[model samples]
Target: MKQVFKRPESLIDVPAHFCPGCHHGIIHRLVAEQIDQFGLRDKTIGVASVGCSVFMYDYFDVDVLESPHGRAAAVATGVKRSRPDNFVFTYQGDGDLAAIGTAEIIHCANRGENVTVIFVNNTVFGMTGGQMAPTTMPGQVTTTTPFGREVATAGYPIKMTEILVHPTIS
Candidate 1:
């Protein structure tokens, strides 16, 4: 018999610290699978920003950088610019990428940075309790908005990809 469910070599052989029912571990597995499939284990550098996945450095075997809150894009940009030969990627949450680091990601995309970004949008801020995030869906309830989100007063949940792909004129 052959083993078909071996863990990816790019990922550490340890249990993840993510909360139960959370998709962070799933996302990590996907990233590790890609790294292993592309034989980039030796060339990949991951940037971990503040949020639920901040302990990613302990999960991946490759070099990992811990960026300030919502600054993963900027840190990854520097890493990629300095080492253009390496494959740099950033793992960030909706709160980090869409709310706090909005400008960083937009500018990085605009400048065509040679880096990959894995943005996880869970709607609420996972690390800091279940608070409303920039990607929260319409009428979604959170710690910050116990009565469900009020679009009239709170404005709309931002669609980051839309803004990145096509910026609207103010």
Candidate 2:
């Protein structure tokens, strides 16, 4: 038996820009592993928006495109359509996906866009001073919700996957 450790070929061999204990590093490795496994590194495009995930361009060895806040999915849609041969994916945080990018993601999924959306739901806007995001659970406290999120006013956390899975909105 032989044991070996190596970096994914699609991943850049460099220190991650994420904060200590951040899962972004692990997730990035997984994305890179998939890219390498599928031999899609040369034909892959990662879309990142205004959030911690925007640094994906620094970690992944493939081509990356930066988008405005909450527009990763929309940008990825265009990329996948324009370059049908390329594999397109978006890396977005809770605030970027579940909040401002909600409509874009929903529409993209509903349209059956051939793209992967890596939505990171951390509850807080980690890149923006720990603010409450749409994915923040009820009763969660943050800089914007020091007294906890009030369901009566804030409603419930948006379950994006579930919303995207339903065939019809009721």
Candidate 3:
């Protein structure tokens, strides 16, 4: 018999600690597949922020650096600059990327940094007790917002990466 199910070499064989129904585990698997497909696991350097992906180092068998909340892009930028040969990427959340690290990501994008950024925009902050995040939908309830988010005060959901999307960035 032959083994038909083969796990990505970049991912470790172990159970993940993500919440039930959470998409982190699935997302990690996809990222691992891409890393393996590109054969860049040896040179991949993952920058993890203070969100759900903080434990990315545990799952991916690659050099990973923990960055301050919302600073993963900034840290990845520096790492890529220092070692251009290395494949650098950042795994960030809505709160970290859209709210706190807005400046860093914008600058990083504007400068056309040669790095990959995986942005997970879950409306609520799952790791931080399900608090409302920048991408939280209007009228959606969260721990931070007891009676649902009021559109008048909270405004609408912010799509930070929308400005960066284009046919080509050069």
Candidate 4:
């Protein structure tokens, strides 16, 4: 019989470790499908960020590199520049992309690197025990902000996509 229920050709056989309601698994499958549909599986290079999805390399059946905490963009830039023919992409979370790697993301976007970024914004830092992240909404309660985030002290969450569209960056 034909293999109709088998996993996608661009994804690994192993099950993901994300939470039941987490969207990482869906995003991973979408990326994998895109890689296969676009015939880029052989020439795709994925950069895994250091957040909950850090183990993204284990799920995709392609070349993957793990970036240091909040450095996926920098690593992706190098990979894309080094192999212009290959399709490079980065998987990052709100915390990884909006916090420690903020400068790197800004610089990479400003340079207009030919890379796709899959940014997952769940508000809080899921991997690090749900701490308040730069993307966490104001008044959101997290492990680090048990009493809800205070705009007066913690400041408002960073709007990454909006920032990326700035004239200087876009």
Candidate 5:
């Protein structure tokens, strides 16, 4: 029998826990596919952040570490520094990365850490009752912002990649 579909070796066989309409599973598959393509399954170490994808350790076949809420970048930094030969990455959502772990992520990028960050910007805090996250678009509504987000008061959504690449950061 010819198998047309097979799960990436870097991903586990267990069912995912991500909710419907959520992109966590798709993002996870992409990450796993990259790891498989690079033949990094054995040498890759993943840092699982808080929020919806906290159970990432159960999905990825590689070694996975759990970081404190919003501390995945810091934890991945230490892991990469301790074992420079390994490929380290962090799986973080908008709520965890853009809101709680902003400082940690900025510092990690500024220092040019040898790590990859798989940031999933779903706009809302999916794990925490769909609250308004830092990545929530302007005029978008969430549980916390019942009347839609007010940029005058809430400020614009943060563009993390731009902040990371800003010249002022270096």
Candidate 6:
């Protein structure tokens, strides 16, 4: 049988801590592959937000900056602005981006910050024991919402893409 080997320059090693059926691993691989394909390993600067992905810095071989909860965008803004020649991106989960960092994201997108944001909307806060996130479904039950989320009180899930695509904003 022909043996398949890992990409020679890929940064990720085996043994990830993500849960079964979680998409984080796939996303991480995709990002790493893109970095390799574009020869961006040296020019890319990743900003990792709090939550499950807080340890992303350990996985990626490139330079990374750890940002406080809900503050990845702010940090990325500074990095990109300071080093405009480098590629900058943020990896953020729903709880970090849609919930705690809503204002920062809005302003960043509105201002057209020259950075990319990878927003993972898993519907629940994964790290904090699966609590209801701002993107959780209306009827989904979470640790914090044992009886299912009520739209009347909690309001609708914020569609971040929609918010970012608004004509005035984008």
Q: Superpose all Cα atoms of candidate 1 onto the true structure and report the RMSD in Å to 1 decimal.
A: 1.7
* TM-score of model 4 vs. true structure: 0.92
lDDT of 5 by residue, 77-131 (tens): 9999999999999999889998999999999988888999988898999888999
Worst 10 residues of 3 by lDDT: 161-170
User: Per-residue alpha-carbon lDDT of model 4 for 1-170, expressed as tens digits?
Assistant: 77666566899999777888998888888888888889999999999998787878889999999996789999999999999999999999988899988999999988888899999899989998999999888899999999999999999988899888772922
RMSD of candidates 1 onward, in order: 1.7, 1.7, 2.3, 1.9, 1.2, 1.9
Q: Model 4, poorest ten-residue lDDT window?
A: 161-170
Location of the lowest summed lDDT over 10 successive residues in candidate 6: 5-14
What is candidate 5's TM-score against the reference?
0.96
Q: Which lDDT tens digits does candidate 6 get at residues 120-157?
A: 89999998899999999998999998999999999899
Clashes of 4: 0
Instruction: Give residue 85's lDDT in candidate 5 (0 to 100).
Output: 98
Write down the lDDT that model 4 would get. 0.89
Number of clashing residue pairs in every model?
0, 0, 0, 0, 0, 0
What is the C-alpha RMSD, rounded to one decimal, of candidate 2?
A: 1.7
TM-score of each: 0.95, 0.93, 0.93, 0.92, 0.96, 0.92
In model 1, how large is the Cα lDDT of residue 135? Answer: 87
- Candidate 1 TM-score versus the reference: 0.95
Report how far residue 155 has shifted in candidate 4, in Å: 1.2
User: What are the lDDT scores of the predictions, listed in order?
Assistant: 0.89, 0.89, 0.87, 0.89, 0.90, 0.88
In angstroms, give how far residue 166 of model 1 lies from its true place. Answer: 3.2
Model 5 misplacement above 4 A: 167-170
Error of 6 at 82 (Å): 0.9
